[model samples]
Target: MAKLENLVQLLDRSLSLHGPRPLFGTKADGRWSWITYAEFGQLVARFRGGLASLGVQRGDRVALISNNRVEWAVAAYACFSMGVAVVPMYEAQLPAEWAFIINDCEASVAIVATPQIYEKCRDLPEKAPSLKHIVCLFEPEGPDGAPGARTTSYGALLAAGEKGPAPAIDPTAADTACLIYTSGTTGNPKGVILSHGNIASNVCAVLDLIPFGSADRSLSFLPWTHSFGHTGELHVMITVGASMALSESVDKIVANLAEVHPTVLMSVPRIFCRIYEGVQKQMTEKPALVQGLFRAGLRAAARQNKGEALGLVERLTLAAADRVIFSKIRDKFGGKLKYAISGGAALSYEVAEFVDALGITVYEGYGLTETSPVVAVNYPGARRLGTVGKPIPGVRVEIDRSETHDSRQGEIVVYGPNVMVGYHKRDEENKAVMMEDGGFRTGDLGYLDEDGYLHVTGRIKEQYKLENGKYVAPSPIEDKLKLSPLINNAMVYGDNRLFNVALIVPEMTALSEWARGEGLTFDSPGAMLRHPRVIARVQAEVDRCSSDAKGFEKIKKVALTDEDFTAENGMLTPTLKLKRRVVLAKYAPVLDALYSGSTKAAPREAAPPG
Candidate 1:
């Protein structure tokens, strides 16, 4: 088995592989860009030298706050070669969050893309007491009103580094490579210190499952702040000598995909699910004959599932529908897409199975940022509709809290080289978590089936108890509710009361437009949410979903959220997972009103505990 001696090896090997071919593709114009592995190497070398000139030495923490630009990738490579630990901050982070992470990571120098990003934490030196410099990655017009304290332009750094003597570098796998801060469910972020080997081992192991070639082209939209995107889309592509086209933004991905025709696609569940929802909405509005055709195609699919022999007529009908209808749907995502992988969140089987039915293979990966993010993935080699496939080679997965069946179940704990070195400088904290022998306990709950394939349930920490002492897992319940195209995101509560309730955030664009189509009047998501007909529609969908869940798990009542639960508002983590505690706290009053019977449910909130 190939092992990662250092995470930076990806940079060395990638720069060496297909040296004459393009490695990074970006826009020189609306639809044009250029790349060559040789040029990539030169850029990385310059950045490294520049950082060195600024007194950034081995083991120094380098903070990078940028949008997804080619320069960001180059900065990572340069830091790796210099053996400087890099910390990626989301450009999407609020000002306070940006400051907190800089201080917590003890970042010495920063590579920022824009002045606004610098201003977000302009006072970092006072707060961190470790910051030495801030270098802007983009062109500046006479400093562009930047803070004058210990800040320099990227151009100057490049010039200085070009003349600076290269520092002797001897990085190893065990040394810390990067500290990725997961926007915590609580107030501050936790810096997950991943070693070079931790990331490198997973990269090499992944090569065992995915075969990448020179012909492969990837269009990336997932942010580099995420581990799944950092390693899976970025490093793995470079490791394999394939070309990558940087996606402009998530909003432009479909158009970008069509232009790039990526051979491999990586995405979140929300993306695929929205695409499916779009197709469904189209079908529902189609002429009766087209609707009939779609139904027939689905019926045919049902009859010939699981490698069953297909009737000739049925096959022909399905084939015809694929060409006429499904082909257009696939074109939206680029017709050349061989397979798409879903990670970072749970994908509904309804969406997964439907995508598979359409001749596009969809695989789901399960992991946390702490696990170098991939513990198990549902690949074609051993994929099932509902399970996140067996642990990848060399990774051990255990789901705790098994119901005495020896089912290999509970919060999934992983033991592998890919596991993190632990949170930075948090010795007691690290000792409390990482097992002596290297196992890291993942708080996510799950179980392994007979085949050893891992299946994630919900977060053990997210579980809540009811007034009667019953506990409920909100994930599955929330997931089921989100399948309603109108419901963008849902959070379930009701651990202590008589039954469960929910705070539903309707997909305002979809819901308002839907209401308009139905002749309902509304100016905002809130107005649309409370319309009698709109409420009835949502309630009906909720009821249908509820019938399937156990009573305790069902959402007996619900309130509408006027705005989105986002990171800036302290309701969601950076990954977009609802912070159960935060959301519960923020929405307590609304939940009270829910229990007070504004939702008009039978189980009203009982009197408060004294």
Candidate 2:
């Protein structure tokens, strides 16, 4: 394929080459539907014309709030072809966040998914004065549940465009294509300004490595609002003329997987973790002989993956297990999954190995939103167990040892065309992450191994994304907990895991007074902390403090300790700041137990503290 100057060019090329090929697959009324590339191209052109009728022009911004749908794709491409930037927000995000993003980006139009969402955002214009139009993908219902009001439906937009087609303006490589908002440590989300060239270069570089083509199909559930899903899955698939089946919802992914028989799956670590857990759960129900065979096969596969010589007996056992056990697991995935691309957060090595042993290659990659979300990835020919593979073409990576105490690893600095122009309008934040030589400081601490594969160690920034790829900034939540007299100190812990848990230290004096008021008795501090009543009380405080937090940011579980982090304990720095690594290391077991359904601070017996 010719070098993609912009995303519009990519769309046009695919239309010319694969006009009759299926481009999008959508599910509705318990049935699957497909739209061809030519049909998609025509829709984009009409949508662009409709947007123009509303006075949307080059350099203007359109805010989109929806889950993955055919209309969402149409709106995005339409905006991109007109040199308009699309600001996409997650449907799962709070309505307040949507308003903030709309105002921040000064969006001229806001396109939402459903009538319910429109109801939530109807008052947004009062808050976001820049927003002039609110277009709903579905028509809004009146008091009797029929089509109502002036809210423009997606179909209406297409009709308007068809009546008076707007010419597609080929955007330059440097024009901003989208603003992807990601959470920061202390404040509201910051918009990462990615240009057309930034994402196009990433897609082209990834296409050169991965073996996706027109025949490949993907069941896409990952939100395109995320850079990984947008550029990596949506854009990359379009470039190669691959079809994508939009998953109905997260709960229906498995059913859709079987129905679509997709050749590719682009997802975060959480999805793979669920698949591994499901397989393990099924194995527990199998006969002893089958379970033994499965375990032996998995062990042999692991050894082989490590390049260890396999005995003839082990090889035979693996082949038998593949036919009897693994094949069924693959069948649940429709037996057509060529490979899965795991990104957004670090995937567990065990999960990757489990999927690989089942004949599905899981190509793990690492990147941040600031770098168009793809720095390095393991592909077909080159893969390592723990490391994200070598940097893609046109990307340069260097380690800044001065940022870390460990000589072998440091902050990863990247320079590439894929790098974003900068965070929108945040010059100070830009200066902090941009290097003197134009390299972007990745904030992640990692190292390149002897073979040039990158091994991610840890993060320098306290902000982290959970296994589900939702970013959480612990300090703000921790600070809120400490505000309660019941909580003397708190540290939220959930990085690359399903949900958030916290380790909290109680105010001993206040706790004792409360215990006395409740007529509770206990011998030691640990015993007092472990009392069910005390645990419930502290949990109440946590609930009260985090009531306003986003759903993902709220603490799901808690572990209590009488031990306070102090300078002497090395959990606190000389400046009285919490040393997160030290705190996590000391309380790792207790915190981990919370996720395993063992509420460590809740006692088995009815013991009271006084």
Best by TM-score: 1
Assess candidate 1 and give its lDDT. 0.77
Candidate 1 structure quality by residue, lDDT tens digits, 412-448? 7799888987887678778767887678878777888
Best by lDDT: 2
lDDT (Cα, tens digit) per residue for candidate 2, span 144-174: 2212213677888899999999999989999
What TM-score goes with each of the models? Answer: 0.93, 0.79
Which ranges of candidate 1 are over 4 A from the true structure? 1-3, 143-149, 165-170, 298-305, 402-408, 509-528, 600-610
Pairs of residues at least 3 apart in sequence or in different chains that clash in candidate 2: 520-609
Q: What stretches of model 2 exceed 4 Å from their correct place?
A: 142-150, 463-610
Model 1 / residue 320 / CA error / Å? 1.2
Question: Can you give the lDDT of residue 57 in candidate 1?
Answer: 82
Candidate 1: residue 361 Cα off by (Å)? 1.1
